[model samples]
Target: MLEIIGVGVALIIAVFLVLAARQPDVCHIARSIFVAAPPERVFPLVDDLRAMNEWNPFAKQPSVRNVYSGPERGVGAADDFSGDAGSGSGRIEIVESIEPAKVALALRMDRPMKCSNRVEFTIAPQNGGSLVTWDMKGRQPFIGKLFSLVMKPEKMVGGAFERGLADLKTLVETAREEAAQ
Candidate 1:
């Protein structure tokens, strides 16, 4: 009976390894939200890494420590973060900033794992508001592919992206309302 159980577990492990090996070497995940404010109003919030704390779900964690460097709102800006187990440690730098239209970042994560990725935010006018899309893409090594098989990067990170966008929407709209008062 014990032997049979061992064989069953081994089979399951083999199947998982096979699936992981079959996964793509590259992965991409994107999520978007429509903020009730114009692109001009929403652009600065994302362009400034320090201001990102106002809307980034991960930045809100009590255990996370964030450090900002370089210019406040454009290329050369960067942020380094270290936090609890759930938060990990990473550095994000703005490599491209297109003012009210797009911002692109290079992200390097260490601690829980070492990986590099690119993130971008594009803001476009739509229906009197702004449509903001957040995208992340990266190269997945064998280890990363295996981890994705278990964690499913899209569902894991994509959920965070969705929440961040919601927070951004609320932050922009609330600020706009307050300014009008």
Candidate 2:
């Protein structure tokens, strides 16, 4: 009986390893929304880390703390988030900032796992408003690949992006309307 149990556990472990090995080396998640405001009107919200946290769903999560460093806003600006709950410890910094159109960031996770990722926010003029897209791309570490075997990483991570985008849409659109009035 003990031998059978050992074999079962071994088999499960073997299968998990095989599946994890088969997982993609890269992971990409993207979410987008349209705000009833021009790119210029919406640019500041994303370009500034402080303004972004106002609409960032992750920032609203309980137990997360953020420390600002480098610069107040724009390129070279960094935010080091430290905490044990929610998304864990990470450092996020703006790598590129293009006026009223695009902002790119580097995200480095320190705890729970270690991996470097890229985040991009793009604003484009469309349908009388701006089409905003947020994208994250990263190389999956071994643990991340293993975790993906039992979870859908895209849905798990993209859901936050979706919520953040919704909040951003509401904030920008409401501000736009108020400014017109």
Model 1 lDDT tens row, 63-164? 999889999889999999999888889999999999899999999999688889999999999999999999999999899999998898899999999999
Off by over 4 Å in 1: 1-7
lDDT of each structure? 0.93, 0.90
Instruction: Please write out the lDDT profile of model 2 over residues 121-163, one tens digit for every residue.
Output: 9999999999999999999978899988777879888999999
Pairs clashing within candidate 2? none
Candidate 1, pairs of clashing residues: none
TM-score quality measure for candidate 1: 0.94
Return the top candidate by TM-score.
2
The parts of candidate 2 lying over 4 Å away from their true place are: none
Give the distance in Å from residue 110's predicted Cα in candidate 2 to where it truly belongs: 0.7
Error of 1 at 69 (Å): 1.3
